[model samples]
Target: MTRSATARTRILNCTLTLSIILHAPLALAKTPVATGTGGAVATISEQASRSALAILDKGGNAIDAAVAAAATLGVTDPFSCGIGGGGFMVIYLAKDKRVITIDHRETAPAAFTPATFLENGKEIDFDTAVASGAAVGVPGTVRGWHEALERYGTMNFKQVLAPAIDVANQGFTVTDIFSRLTRENERKFQQFGTTSALYLRDGKALPAGTMLRNPGMAKAYREIAARGQRAFYTGPMARAIVDAVNRPPVAGGAGVRAGKMTLADLANYEARIRQPVASTYRGYALYGMPLPSSGGVTVAEALNILEGYDLKAMPRADAEHLYLEASRLAFADRNAYLADPEYVDAPVAGLLSKAFAAQRRTAIDPKRAAASVAAGDPYAYQEDQSIPLRPQARPLQKENAHTTHFTVSDKDGNVVSYTFTIESWGGSGIVVPGYGFLLNNEMTDFDFSGPRPNVPEAGKRPRSSMAPTIALKDGKPAFTIGSPGGSTIITTVLQTIVNHVDFGMPMDAAINAPRLSERNGAATSVEPGFAGSAQARALEAFGHTWEATPEEIGAANALVFNPDGTVTAVSEGRRHGVGSALVQRKGH
Candidate 1:
């Protein structure tokens, strides 16, 4: 057969297999809320959810299911996450009753410096910086997956990777979001020969409903499945990745300078197991990702401030004002203190301290928003006074909207809340030749030209807004929650927890509730559902400016553990993603 004929046949066969797998009677039985005596999985992709459920059905634990689901997402939702990205995972181990956090965030190359993005004493153009090799960070997703599997998962890498490999090889139907994103990023993708070959066909973006096959991605997965983490970080794939990042920009393009990442950077990458930042609110313990990710500290600080108010007794308007007020304060601290702990002292202990939060809370006026909030002296509350406290510099905040989040839990009570990203949609818009994946532009998360703690530094992980969290009640996992919305991630997670604990809503309702986000900025953005409501009017009355943005507040997914041992899983349903709970088959 001709090469084109073979390609067509493969695509056809893959489509048939996908149809059978997705529409089979057993698969059809899976619902958004699957009540199984065994386990449940909630994620942003249907294929990913199914893959996770299959792992559960095969007697794999929650970690196994999460790894399986995350890998499948790399294949099905490549625009948001892939092996080339990095993330954080919060895992609850049932047997040991322990919660562990894995920090696989991408790091700046060894050659990076504070002035990497500055040219002639001015910051380079943001668009040019985003599309250039300088934006590429040493990817940590593959190492993170390996660490999770080795430490917590029961299945081997090969077993968990098979589903993703099959998905990439067989092909999947593209959704409207995918098609739209491709069109929006067509220029960036076309700037590179390799990216254009993968994302575009005949100089045109693929339309929705088309079968998108990525045999090259399948091969990459296969290699990893066979050789383990070394395949990606120390072998042929590593060389290919470095080569692509260092490749010259397309002729006449306004791309930034070539990357200086070395193969040593890839080989030295390790996913650290960090202590989760913990706090208590309304008798529940909230655990979130630590430094490098400002999520936990910020959430904890906000909740601590809110704990002073009787939210249920207060008028809804007053509660809304207080919520936004606390968010502003927490974000103020986040901007000042949060960064890669390896490069800066993040003052985690001071930031999450209830006493400090109480002190900060005193500045909030229930009747009106503050004119402007500034970072507090949380370090003053700490016993260790040796940590230098520097004057905080306000850095320009960049919006990164593309990322993926998933939650999984097994009947035995193991749970996983994972959020991963490539920094933005299509990432740096550069593809490793024949690798079939986009590399992360996570380096752009750093402050480009500022004296901020998060400014780029060699071997430093970029400050991330990806917050994966788990709430515990009475020392057991109560809920697993997270979202994707750049700076909005902190507020989204805060609101969801509030909706559940304070508003008395179920997991699904809490996730679906209207969201309002303010990141200590000039304007607060509200969803359409809340734009004209009494709450918005009240917030406006409080001297807060409202920006009615069409942007989705968050794409959050969560799993609530019922007292009766049943699990309720929910996907935000903001974007076109599906959620499911898995039940054990009679024969299985």
Candidate 2:
């Protein structure tokens, strides 16, 4: 069958049924309260949410509260994001109507060789390359957060870190989500003494509401507060990391080689600042991740193409079909032309253009899915950009279960959308000693081939699917949102934008609404809970396939502003998170 027909059948039959099973009805997502405003924050953790509120109550700006809350989250919600990982920060300064993207992404070790992962001219399995030190990238989250605080925040690092110190020193109730993930990965933790000691209590993961403490993490926070990034990257913390990483693992084990990452790699790493990939569709300006991340450009292209249709008028299933087809076209382009701008040429400017979007949209069939769409030659459109195309052998599909994210907005109109991950649970099962966390297995995200040919090239950033985005209407900030779910991140953010901008749903409604995803022209997966029988059946008629799970959509945190000046915040129920609004009391 053609890719389009297959997608139509799969969506109508298989994927549709699965979505209904996963998504709870929309009514379940409603909150009792209506629109409210003042200063509010939504994140993936409760204690951290409370901490942000405390900062607001204490006269700290949103940036201050965000930094404080972020520190607290690192200690309390270690399963998702922490100091050990690196991510981007999108800051919106309402005063100047400016949005800045701080790209503190992790880079490969200097000693990394392009052909390091190849075995006898064949590419290595994704997991094998990732579990090795070859996967470790220089972490930049701490410095990135600190930079935001220093530049725009009112509170000091010490003050903001206090909340985290309290949580780590005294401990907080272990929530259900925390306990569940820990238990699921207990065996990996058990294999590493330090890992087991930190997360597992008496050979079992901490139960919900169990008081858990992390004095080590707190101490590490203190060092950062006092000495800044240097303390963590090269000081005692560095020594501790080297010591832990250098420890040889048990024979026939997954422990990475000791000292595979040298101090030089840590010292040479530098976070970058690049322009946010941007495009306009139906008058709304869309901004997303740039080169080194396939998310921003690909999402822009998808949105641009979808703009041609009146999604609101179409049935949810038909709209979904259109989205899947457009996503497939975008992903095909992503697999072909998207790469690190620093290492490889990327036709970003050409790809996000209106003309390019129109051309790509022509390949889409509103009635059926296009099973296969070849990537267009970006050079054909942009003369200045060109890269020789080389096809690499396809590797096995490896499912990765690791990702975390949070969004923060200060009263001053400073906003940050941060996403990070360990690539998998307990990343490589190697603890960085005193750092109290596992290193990311991001290397697995790359296609390991040969020396410089789709290989593990040192300093080359991997393609990330993380899509933390901010939307603007006529050049004004309208919404800020992001999610965790690997490939699912892109679809979730796109839907939230549509839910708010196109459907006029409230912040909570948009975030809590059902989500679906299509990667590289493959099957479209919907959160079973969101689709009804009619929509599901329609999708099958369109030839899209589905995989049912407990929830079709992953967690998303968001903030939105209406024309009336009311601000609303939201977080999904599926996550161990809370969304709070501190709107001025009515008639106050």
Candidate 3:
């Protein structure tokens, strides 16, 4: 290895040695909560959970188990994620004693720009764009998997992919959620030849509990297992992906508006290693993803703003009001300034600074919610304030509620918090023929109508709300948590942490608790339980406008490292469907 790589490895070796001496926590299974001594995995699927546990049982590290679980998810949770998409991965290296992030978020093609989503000098209809290949971004999951394995895993591609291939070939039982989503996008799915044949029969969703198989995904995995990432980026599969985008199916008796992807764009695709965004709150150090994902910065800033208050000592209703306000202020700043760091300037350190949070906290009126809120200036908190703060503007967009999050921990104390998506369910409504994968419509995440920072540009990643996070107590990970809920992801993660850390709720209880999301908008959205609660009534006394929604906010998967050395893994009990959490070896 090179000098820098060797140095990093030396630190890694030190941590590995220390981890070897530490006893691992085991866990329970097929349910939302698992506790034991050894290791654990929690996600949206039983197949995914089992795949990781099996890896841990066979002596794989957190990275290996995570990739195995992710591949299995691609097969089973195909609509939510697959090899056609990209995501952010946050990992705590038990050996290195530090956190690292991989920014594999999909990028805009080299020829893309602000006008790509516009038609005749006007922005195109969102639904029309979503269903066309114009929304597709370069597939990044395969390359992302390669990067994760090469950097930290002990197993080969073949070893980790074996389970996923089996699932795809043998099939898994369909559930209500899967059937419902298919029916929701039935018309759009019918438009594409490959997508239609793969997801529907006789213009209807496959019946729930039916064994659904996708030999195409199995073949795709086998090719990657044999040839590596090149199989997707530069080999035969690459041509297939390029064709699916540049020559999308006709819509409304005409060619689609914007599809400019080229083979070179796919060939040049690469995942990056980004420094983790770090901050502190309540005597604990928090580490999250850097730019490209606003979740880390926004969540940390919200917590920092809330730090000025003694939440634990206050009445629960009063404390919740403060949480909503902090979130409002943080989102104003996020919407105003955050975007792809590669294409625009962002006040990274300034956004996370305690001084900035302190200044922003002054806007909170403890007794009432603000009638209106504006973005705060964080540039002053940084030594270099050259990047001027941009004006605030709200992007017109559709809310996507189908992203997925998973958490895994190994016997060596290594932890993984991964969140990925295909943008919307059944992404782009087109599947590459013979590939058995859906392409990502992630580019539509760009602000289609603004001179804003998040406006689409060549090779720039869209700003994301996906936050995969790890909290450290005294320099060791106390717990790792993340959720999937589109824009609500930030608030979901923030409130869950506040619930557990400040209000003293158990991890499982914390996840199941009602969630509220305030984005400096006219109304704050609340779950059914929260909308009618005493707390919601109390918040209304503070002039908070409530928009009660029947839909669940987020499906979160989390793992808590206990003082007794046993680990507790938790998943959402009711959102979407019943999730699965498993431990390698549960205490007797």
- In terms of lDDT, the best-performing candidate is 3
| Clash pairs, model 1 backbone | none
**What are the candidates' C-alpha RMSDs?**
7.3, 6.6, 7.6
List, residue by residue over 236-354, the lDDT tens digit for candidate 3: 89888888888875434544544789889999998998889998889999988788999899999999999999999999889999999999888888888889888878887888899
Best by TM-score: 3
Roughly what TM-score does model 3 have, to 2 decimal places? 0.94
Better of 1 and 2 by lDDT: 1
Off by over 4 Å in 1: 1-26, 29-31, 248-256, 393-396, 576-588
Residue pair clashes in candidate 3:
15-95, 24-38, 25-37, 25-38, 26-36, 26-37, 26-38, 27-36
- TM-score, candidate 2, is 0.87
- Residue 240 CA displacement from its true place in model 3, Å: 0.5
Candidate 2, 256-309: lDDT as tens digits:
543357777677667777778877767777677787766788788888888888
After TM-score superposition, the amount by which residue 531's alpha carbon in candidate 2 deviates from its true location, in angstroms, is 8.0
